[model samples]
Target: MFCLLLSVMRRIICSLATQLVALIVVIINWYQWDKEVEGYIEHKAVLCEFMSSALHEAPASYDDIKGKYVFGRTTRPQFFSMLHRYNVIQAYTQKKEFVWIGISARPWFIGFAVLQFGYVSVFCIQLYNTVTRESWKAKTTVPLFGWLFGGKWVSNVHGSVGPTAEGHSVDFSAPFTGQSAKIRFVGGGLEFDVSGTVKKVEGLPSRKPTLAARYELSGSAQLPKEFLGLVFPLGPRRAAVVHKFSAVPLSRPLSVGIGEGVWHGMGHISMDYTRGLLRRDTRWCWCTATAPEGYGFHLSAGTYDIGGKSMENSFYANGKVALLNTAVGFRKVFEKMVKAEEENIDISSGDTLRWAVTGDGIDLQFACVDSHNGTVHCGVVDGNLNHSWGIFNGTITVNGIVYEFSDVPGALEQHNMRW
Candidate 1:
């Protein structure tokens, strides 16, 4: 019927241009003229009141330059243990990709990402609220990928006002170039626009809800950009400014309609473009998955301008990449991961928390199951992060075979933006 009347006039002109940009973002969030989003929403509402005073006790007294609405000139405490370089000749590159349209027996988990830096271009819509362990994100930044030293011609609209996400209550991160990271084309990609809601906070414990789902993910990816890639740099100026990853999935499953739910599984995507210069007070541990000889792994025990070349311990399987030379003590493997919740003495609430890592030959085992710790305002000063969604049990011998895993699906992280 004439293409269903041009898809209902393009969904009524994109819902009246998203209700006129949500009525001009409720009048610029009531005139808070963007001081890097009023110092990241007053440093994430003082880290959400220090994460609700961490469920009971802790986190009082914090004043390093008036709680970060924008800070620098960290009063050189003797050059703060020397080491601060990320120039890579005026670098500031970026490139991205993310794909996880899952199905481990149905019940949905969708994520489609994209990004291109310098004169901006971003999109991220991640949803994995399969009834708890909450997550429903959204992001958008425009300028449509301009180039040549990439700057100027910008636009923004950040998210999370619901879906149990009590962070980013309208920030514009003004005066620009504040890349606290936080993807491309294929078989027809790039289309998203969904807006908020996921209440439950009046008195907590409704599985602790208070998130907003303001997603606007777009897409595109169909191979060839070297089929599966990498481009190293983790030192000097721009201390690790280029990480190109390409996940090639989706040969079978596909069914969509998120919000009032309807999503199946089996999907993988990728896009990565990065331009350097970022390193100031660090602590990192980045895990990636969807395996079979390799499609992820990035560990860090330290990186202050990747000085001695741990280059973020690399390993990307099946298509190849093996960069590793040092840095993997993860602070003595986090003392064997804080003894994994005291050896999971019968972990309740949809349980799953087991940890292991062994020998100079690696004998790993990780089964997370669920985790979503938060405390935003990243890039330092009380910026915690623990976003885990599990499944990684047994074997990993690589060229020596042994590669085994039953529950498969993966993603595990541990972050502390210099806490």
Candidate 2:
């Protein structure tokens, strides 16, 4: 009885604290600065109009000054150069090499990283089998991240298969220095490679043109340092410049063997390279889905700066890209069991996880067959990443056209980090 009472009291305190924070944010952004948020929805609609035009314009590169937000589906070398020029010892930055390659109609995801913050240099590699729900991850940290000496850059990302109580493992390494449109990951049991070419837009094209092996995306967004810290009292502001590229439904033949299973099929590859001056504590939610006939969407929410003018939400179908201008919301339908002994729940049995991603013209439901949870505690750096893989079902109404989807292969993720 006493423990139950304590839990109730804790719940009350948490609820009150949440309400207080919401009140403060509303007062700061909406009431105090009335002009900024007047007709909020209508304002967002106008911004979306402007965004659509800008995407159509599709500037080749960002201006060197850096403050304005930009969007597009092509790579900008100037953005990469700008990130490398800014030096903030307290800030963290990374160039992530990520790929989601489909084999034999099955999905496999890979992640490799070269990151630096202060004097800490971190490298990471993650592999996931979406259908089987098996994952392998490894990371390492060193004192000195890298160096640029006499116009030459030098560093390396190195990792090995170590002792694991269960599941699979692999050893991998790649050069961390410089940028490359072509990337290769060589390891003890895996060989994967991707060749990328820039898709250039000569003029203001009505629709984005496809490339043989399109390999880059450029975007920028402003976000607050802490979760739900849109108001100044919570945390300072931060910015991120990102590059993404995709080659969906690759026509070329690809085959791979993992464990005792072998997969063979035409594959798909997607990659993201990000650089940010982020906060010490941050949290975000992200989801991605790839459907047949060149349809896919990327949805992300959490960590918006004051005014919330910049958003990262877009979907592409049949080679035409459209922006989702409204805010996105996420609700977890399958709750994680907190007290196993009392609840009599077996987490290993793999219950179907569900999440509803909804917005003005978007409604996406992701149902997971299996999930992978990872937690790392390396002193000051503590992180939790939960990933669930399954299918998506729902409808999105865009420009008066209702797009219906059923049983689309996708993944949902919840990530929290403190560094």
Candidate 3:
């Protein structure tokens, strides 16, 4: 009888594995059309040319960038609706903010992100008046290294609220995918009133986001013409257009506080504004930066979807993008950093996390020295985000010219999203 039960369990496990493999193959073919593949090679060549031209200097802002990364009439929101509105796509919109600051004069930082996708959103903000700044004690996640670690810690003794994410109460519009979005949330440690509009910027492909907010402060971005873009397949069909820029000010001058304390600081904010028709159980790697070279790189690959086709592997630098279909695995290059600090490193436990990128002869590596910042934890039937911004070092060889990074600051992330 025991043997029979074991045999049945084996069969079930085998069946599940087989189904999983089949799903992956379907996802691969979904985005891998011959025409698209052919176009990709041309796009890469154009991107590399732009990168080569501006390899020596960094643009002050997106204004200083120009290239063939412009979107045509077909790339706009209206064009998509007109073309595929006939039950050809399942649209989804998501807005996420990741704020990590190098507080005051100390190396310590405290920050979190508010993630909203589909009908669910998670507020990772401690929502507290003033969070205690400590580096020794692991905040929520157990810390790994000392000097290399950079993140915020929510104290347990202070009896502070962690993060809150659940089904929202607001009305979701029908398949809205644009830079103009308005939303307000009230409750717990999270209360926000903000309206985002599109503003025309000089010398750019399109009008990006100009945020009008109540807390923190107003912000804007002249998003570059080039970006990490992908078009997914049919049946619960998903497509994504994502742009990332670094902004700041997670909290304001204690204006909307519940208990009356102080909350204000400055750090790098990775504002990921995206419009997509997402599939279930999808995963992607997305990271960005604004300084030390005005770099913006992203990779979107996952399980519900395969990374092999219609993938997002574009790196933006000095206002141009270089396509890297296989550069998503550049994190492996970070192995050298780990080996150098072997005395204090331990990746087996996942305590010593890594974040990196390599492309078209350009490679970067960094480690999440500490894991103080809590997970971008989302609820069930939703997705979770894991990313950390920290100091890193490596050499980027553009056209064989080496530009070294010395403790340069940036971020790296992996997200698994569901709709």
Index of the highest-lDDT prediction: 2
Q: What lDDT score belongs to each candidate, Candidate 1 first?
A: 0.37, 0.43, 0.34
Model 2 poorest 10 in a row by lDDT = 223-232
Q: Give the higher-TM-score candidate: 1 or 2.
A: 2
Model 2 stretches with alpha carbons more than 4 Å out: 1-81, 84-238, 245-247, 259-262, 303-310, 335-352, 377-379
lDDT of 1 by residue, 23-77 (tens): 7886555322211121221344433442242212111111224431111111000
Q: Order the candidate numbers by lDDT, best to worst.
A: 2, 1, 3
TM-score of 2: 0.53
Model 1, clash count?
39
Q: Runs in model 3 with CA error above 4 Å?
A: 1-114, 124-217, 225-230, 234-237, 244-271, 299-310, 330-350, 355-362, 369-384, 399-401, 416-419
Write down the TM-score of every candidate. 0.25, 0.53, 0.43
Q: What TM-score does candidate 1 get on C-alpha atoms?
A: 0.25
Model 2 clashes, total count:
1
Residue 86 in model 1: lDDT: 20
Residue 110, model 1: Cα distance from true site in angstroms = 3.9
Q: So what's the TM-score on candidate 3?
A: 0.43
